[model samples]
Target chain A: MEQALYQAAILTFEELGFIFPIERPSDDECENEESTRVSVKFNGSVSGEIVLQVENTILPTIASNMLGTEEPLEDEEILQDVLGELANVICGNTLPSIAGKNEVFRLEPPRKINKLEAGEKPAAIAHLDVEESRADVLLYLN
Target chain B: MKISSRSDDILITYALGSCLGITIFDPIAKVGGLLHVMLPASIVNPAKAANNPYMFVDTGVPELFKACYKAGAKKERLVLKVAGGASLQNNEDSDQFQIGKRNFLMLRKLLWKNNVLIKAHDVGENFSRTMLLEMSTGNVILKINNETTIL
Candidate 1:
């Protein structure tokens, strides 16, 4: 299961074109669980966590790539939507592997979490930080 | 046009990307309805019951069926056609978000318990799709990008 999760994560990262081998998030970086955090966690027959954070500099670039428009979108809602979609893609791509061959797994909707309140439980969290990009991805098992 | 009938025509449409859409229709009375549901069920937002009842599978399916029956559609004559469980770009990250699969499974479970059988369906894969159901003829057309296919 762990191997599957790792492969899924690596495959997702490569497909999305986001360079990684990146740093995993630390306690300090994720100080507040209540703050707006673009995190993806799975629970059910198969469970895990995936988190993403975008650098301020790369935010506009990613926004442009996602929207396919040169015009800037400064709205928080738009940014959140794009990030949510990104997380959704990552989760969808990794399911078959995590759930095993012929195992069907269902996913809940991607939601923005308060970072401060995220780690209250001692779960097996795999924190992934994509560097040189405007986004961050985190994964944990709770 | 949009055939909003209780039993015969249930027409629902939506932009589906890694999301599922379930449609239920009854032909005898020509009253049917469609639901562009995003999630498997409304576990997060019970507050949305009054306004967006169709957002969850459990709530929306029953409402759609009831609405059809009210319009003189018989449950025995109903034929179901489903579409819109598509995936986004393939990636590991995408697997963590299984709204499409969850939505599909939940709908199936609900329908099974109610003794409803899905006659036809198109689900899964990494493609964005749009679905439209013609209530008058019980015809379903799926559009993925520029390609159009009847399912």
Candidate 2:
């Protein structure tokens, strides 16, 4: 599961968002930055969800690169939407590996959530680093 | 199903997931409504449909049109727009759990039977949305994660 999340996040952030992964930052490197989180739930042969949390510092760059525009959108809502899409795509890519290619699953739209609201402990987690930013993906299954 | 002739009337629905948010308006009549349908077919739960006809695509879509027409809307002038019907990644066409796609297909099928056509739509994606219908302007507005657009 961790490998799946890692691969999905790498592929999604690099290929889709055009953001490159970088060396993992030490725990103290990003201690002062704020993080934004999004969650997507899926129901099928096995019900579960993927929660993705990314540092706020790199949001503008991600949005700007994904849209390929001259200027990055500074709107908080637009940034959140971009983050939500990232989480949704990551969940969609990772689920097929764990649930099998033929299994049926319905994924709910991604929504912004806080760490406290993620509820149960995650079954697996992947922490990824990209260009001075950090992202964490958590998988919860029922 | 809610309809209004007054220009100030605005019908809004929020947080659409696998469910659908359907909007229709008639500029001449100034009547419009928004329906949030959860399922594609009423056959899945006839009892629930009987009680809340606006919960399924098959039963609810007809009622929205009927109410609009009764309130001075014409079939020819009614402009329709739909949003929400998102699916998970790599979802096959045969996946029964793809309620978003099924709901959209059922809606199109029902409307096609009536010879009605959709003007515009933002459907089929892995995202949630909030829809608003302004009765005065007959404009269907969609808000996805706070980014707003007209359909």
Candidate 3:
């Protein structure tokens, strides 16, 4: 499940934002103090949440890459929108593999998470190192 | 994870969706600690929990408080403030597993068992929140949608 989800996330991110993710060991010091986390919920044969955390410094690069612009965008809304869409796509693509191709799933819109407090351990956690910046993809099954 | 100086050191945690962010501070010692917890219990995945205890409230909360204590913050003089625990969009059905709500409940249960009370908090909404803890003054700040509020 973790491998499939990681593959789905990598493919979606590359195709949409032209960003690539590389695997790395988890290190608390490497986490950004100011990061953006987006969550999307899916329900069907299986129910769960997909969480994506991207550092603030990498937002402009992600937005510009997705928009095909050379200029770095400082707009928070656009940056969040791109991140949300990336999470949505990853969630949408990863569900079928988990729930079977014939099963249909409903996905809610990706929303920003200001903070994360507690719950189950992420079923799969992928560390993506992109352009000297890092992002995380976490899947939680409920 | 901890700031021990008496200066303007700040510890921040970002985008807590269903997860929770907790801040512990000692005014006398001028020390503070911040923890971001992702789940309610560590029993679900003991292996992962063993590695990343911060991913669960049950394990993370205790560890966070311990860190503060190790930093010279007395438990009796500690101020606790919390934020986060947000439900996902379009979750109108009550039967659906509400991870956010459950997370908050778990937090409350743990605090109660430990005889710790929250000094201030902003939680249980549909929006994400960022939390900041300043060691100098023991002030906890909550940010959401570009707006800031003292927690």
Interface RMSD of 1: 16.8
Error of 1 at B106 (Å): 0.9
Query: Where does model 2 exceed 4 Å of error?
Result: A1-142, B88-96
Give me the displacement of residue B135 in model 3, in angstroms: 1.6
Model 1 agreement with the true structure over A56-141: per-residue lDDT tens digits? 45555455544545454567787777666667677666666656667655566667665535435533333445434323344555
Candidate 3 residue runs with Cα over 4 Å from true position? A1-142, B1-6
**By DockQ, who's the top model here?**
1
lDDT of 1 by residue, B54-127 (tens): 88877888887887777777888888877766656576354665566667766765675577778998887777
lDDT of each: 0.61, 0.80, 0.80
- lDDT by residue (A36-141, candidate 3, tens digit) is 9999998888898998888888888778767766577889889888889999999988888878889988999999887653655778777777657888888889
DockQ of 2: 0.01
Candidate 2 yields a Cα-based lDDT of 0.80
What is the C-alpha DockQ of each candidate?
Answer: 0.02, 0.01, 0.01
What does DockQ come to for candidate 1?
0.02
Estimate the overall C-alpha local distance difference test score of candidate 3.
0.80
My TM-score estimates for the predictions, one after another, are 0.49, 0.50, 0.50
